[model samples]
Target: MVKVTFHQDPVTLVGNEVKVGDNAPDFNVLTNDLGIKSLADYQGKIKLISVVPSIDTGVCSIQTNRFNEEAKELENVSVITVSMDLPFAQKRWREVNNVEDLELLSDHRDADFGEKYGVLIKELRLLARSIFVIDSNDKVTYVEYVHEVSEHPDYDKALEEAEKAE
Candidate 1:
C-alpha cells in the first residue's frame, strides 16, 4: 500500500505490486472510442500513462495539451491520459481541444485500470494524478504519485525519465 496525501491529509492506496525493472501490469481500460485496450496493445513501445482527476478542468487540459504537443514527435511512443470521466466526456474533450496525439482512456465503466495501478481515489470518484513510464520491454522504469490532487506533475522531469527509458 502507498500512503499519499491531499491538502496534508493522508490517503491510502494498494499500489500495483510491480516494481521498476519488473514486468508492467496489464489491465483493460475504456477508450474514448468505446473500446477496451490493454497494455499489450502497445507492446515493445515506450509509453507514458498520465492519470488525472478530470479533463474538463483547466489544469488537466493544460497538462494534456502540453504532453500531446511534446510527445507526438517521438517515434514508437504512446502517451495516454487516464481519467474517471466517461468515454463520451473524454471524446468531447479531445474533439473540442484538438487533442489528437494523446489518447484519452476512461475508467468509468469498470475502473479496473485504476484499481490495478492503485490510482483510484476511494473517497472521491476520481483517479489520483500519476505518471507511469514503461520501457520498450514493457517494464516499469519511472513512476510518480502526485501527493496533492490540486497540482500538476513535473512534466519536464517525467519527459526526461521517458527519454532515459528510450
Candidate 2:
C-alpha cells in the first residue's frame, strides 16, 4: 500500500502498487457506453493509463486534456483515463470538454481498476493521481504515483516512456 495525500492529509491506498517490469494487472472498467472494458481488450498496443480522482476537477481535467492532446501524436498507443466518476458523468465531461482521442473509463461499477492498480483512496472512494505506461506485451514500463492527489503527474516522463517502450 502506498501513502497518498489529498490536500496534505494522508489517505490509505488499497491493493499492490504496480512497479516497472511487472505485468500490468488486468481489471474491468466501464466505458462511456456502460460497456465493460479490460486491459486485455487493448492487447498488442502500448497503453497509457492515466488515473485521476475525478475528471470534473481542475487538475484532473487538465491531466486528461494534456494526455488527450498527446495521444494524437503517439503511434500505436492507447490513452485511457480511469476515475471513480460514474459513466454518465464521464460521458458528459467528455462531451463538454470535446475530448476525442482518449478513452474515459469509469471505475464506479466495481473499483476493480482502482484496486488492482493500487490507486484506490480508501477514505475518498476515489483514485489517487497516477500514471502507468504499459508496453504492447502488457508489462508496465513506467509508473508514477503522484504523492499529492491534487497535483498533476509528470506528463513528459510518462509520454516518453510510452514512446520508448518497444
Candidate 3:
C-alpha cells in the first residue's frame, strides 16, 4: 500500500507496489478506440508508462504532452499515458492538444492498470501520478511514484532509463 497525497491530503493506493527489477504487471486498459490493450501488446519495445489521475488537469496535460514530445526521439520505445478518464475523453484531449506521438490509454473501465501498478487512489477512484520504465523483456527498469499527485515526475531520469533499457 503505497500512500500518496492528493492536494496535500493523504490518499490510499491499492495493489502491489511495483519496483525496479520486478516483472512489469500486465494490465487491461482501453485504447482511444475502446479497444483492449495489455502490457504484452507492447512487447519487444521499451515502455514508458505515464500515469495520471485525469488527463484534463493542468499537471496531467503538461505531463502527457511532455512525454508525447519526447517520444518522437525515443527509438524503439513505446510511450504511453494512462489516465482514469474515458476513452472518448482521451481521444478528444489528444485531438485538442495535438498529442499524437504518445498513446493515451484509459483505465476508467476497470482500473486494471492503476491497481496492478499500485497507483489506484482508493478514495477518489483515480490513479496517482507516476512513471514507469520497462525494458524489452518486460522487466521494470525504473519506477517513480510521485509523492504529490499534483506535482510533476522526474522526466529526465525516467527517459534516461528508458533509453538505457534493452
Candidate 4:
C-alpha cells in the first residue's frame, strides 16, 4: 500500500503501483461513451495512463490537458485519463472542454480497476493522481506518484520517459 495525504490527513492506497519493470495489471474500464476497454485495448501502442482522482479538480484538468498536448506528437501512443467520474460526465466534460484527442475513462461502475492497479484510495474512494507509461506488451516502463494531489506532474520528464517506453 502507498501512503498519501489528502484532505489534510493521510490515506492509504489499496496496493502499490506496478513497479517500473513490472507488467501493468490488465483492467476493464469504461470509456467516456461507457464502452468497456482494457489495457489490451491499447495494445501495440504506447500507453500513458493518467490516473486522477476526478476530472472536476484543477489538478486533474491540468494533467488531462498536459497529456492531450503531449499526445499530439507521440505517434502510436494513447493517452488515457482515468477517474471515478461517471461516463456521462466524462463525455460532457470532453464535449464542453474540447478534449478531442485524449480519452477519458471512468471507474464509477466497478472500482476493481483502481484496486487492481494499486491506486485506489480506500477511505476517500478516489484514485491517487499517478502516471504510468506502459509499453506495447503492457510492461510498466515508467511510473510517477504525485504525492501532492493538487499539483501537476513534471510533464516534460514523464513524456521523455514515455519515449523510452516505446
Candidate 5:
C-alpha cells in the first residue's frame, strides 16, 4: 500500500500497488453512457490511465483537460481518466468543459478500478491522484503514485512513456 495525502495529511490507500513490469489489472468502470467498460476493451492499444479523486475539483479538472489536450497528438494511444464521480456527473462535466479527446470513466459502481489500481482513498471513498502507462500488451511500463492528492502528476514523463509504448 502507498501512503497518500490529501491536503498534506496522510491517508491510507486501499488495494495492491501496481508497479512497472507488472501486468495491468483488469477492472470494471462505467462509461459516460452507463455502460460497463473493462480493461479487456482496450487491448492492443497503448493506454494512459489518469486516476483522479473527482473531475469536479480544480486540480482534477486541470489534469483531465491537460491529458485531453495531449490525447489529440498521440497515436495508437487511449487516454482514460478514472474517478469515483458518478456517470451522470461525468457526463455533465464533459459537456460543460467540452472535453472531447479523453475518455472519462466512473468508478462509482463498485470502486473496481480504484481498488485494482490502488488509488482508492479509504477515508474519503475517492481515488488518489496517480498516473499509469500501459503498453499495447497490457503490461504496465510506468507508474506514478502522486504523493499529494491535490497536486498534478508528471505529465511529461507519463506522456513520454505512453508515446514510447506506441
Candidate 6:
C-alpha cells in the first residue's frame, strides 16, 4: 500500500509493490487497436514501461514523448506507455503527437497493469506516474514510483538501466 500525492494530497495505491530483481508482473493491457498485450508479448526485449494517469495530461504527454524520442535510439528496448485512457484516446494522442516509436497501451478495460504494478490511484481510478525497467529475461532491473504524480520521473536513471539490461 504505497502512498503517492496527486496534487499535494495523499492518495492510496492499490496492489503489489514491484521492486528491482522481482519478476515483472504480466498484465493484459489494450493496444491501440484494442488487442490485448501482456508482458510476455515483449519477451526477449528490454522493456521501459512508462505509467501515467492519463495521456492527455501535460506531465504525462511530456514524459511519454520523451520516452518516444529516446525509444528510437534504444533498439533492443521496447518502450511502452500505459494509462487508464481509452484505446481510442491513446491512439488519437499518439497520432496527434507523432509518437511512433513507442507502444501506448490502455488499462481502462481492467486496471490490470495499474493493480499489478502498484500504481492504481484508488480514489481517482487513475494510475500514479511511475517507470519500470525490465531486462530481456523479464526481471525488473529498475523501478521508480514517482512521489508526486504531476512531476517527472528520473528518466536518465531508468534509461541507463534499460541500456545496461540490453
- Prediction 1 global C-alpha lDDT: 0.84
Cα-based lDDT for every prediction:
0.84, 0.94, 0.95, 0.84, 0.95, 0.94
lDDT of 6 by residue, 6-29 (tens): 899999999999999999999999
Comparing 1 and 3 on lDDT, the stronger one: 3
Clashing residue pairs in candidate 6, if any?
none
Q: Give the alpha carbon lDDT tens digit for every residue of 1-166 in model 3.
A: 5669998999999999999999999999999999999998999999999999999999999999999999999999999999999999999999999998999999999989988999999999999999999999999999999999999999999999999999
TM-scores for candidates 1 onward, in order? 0.92, 0.98, 0.98, 0.95, 0.98, 0.98
- TM-score quality measure for candidate 1: 0.92
Residue clash pairs of candidate 2 = none
Cα displacement (angstroms), candidate 1, residue 117, comes to 0.9
Q: Candidate 3: RMSD over Cα atoms?
A: 0.7
User: What are the C-alpha RMSDs, in order, of all predicted structures?
Assistant: 1.6, 0.7, 0.7, 1.2, 0.7, 0.8
Candidate 5 C-alpha lDDT tens digits along 15-125: 999999999999999998999999999999999999999999999999999999999999999999999999999999999999999999999989999889888999999
In angstroms, how far off is 143's CA in candidate 2? Answer: 0.2
> Weakest 10 consecutive residues, lDDT, candidate 3?
1-10
- Expressed as tens digits, the lDDT of each residue in 35-144 for candidate 1 is 99999999888999898889998778888898999887766789999999999999998998899888999988887888888888777768888889999898889888
Where model 2 places Cα greater than 4 Å from the true spot, the runs are: none
Better of 1 and 3 by TM-score: 3
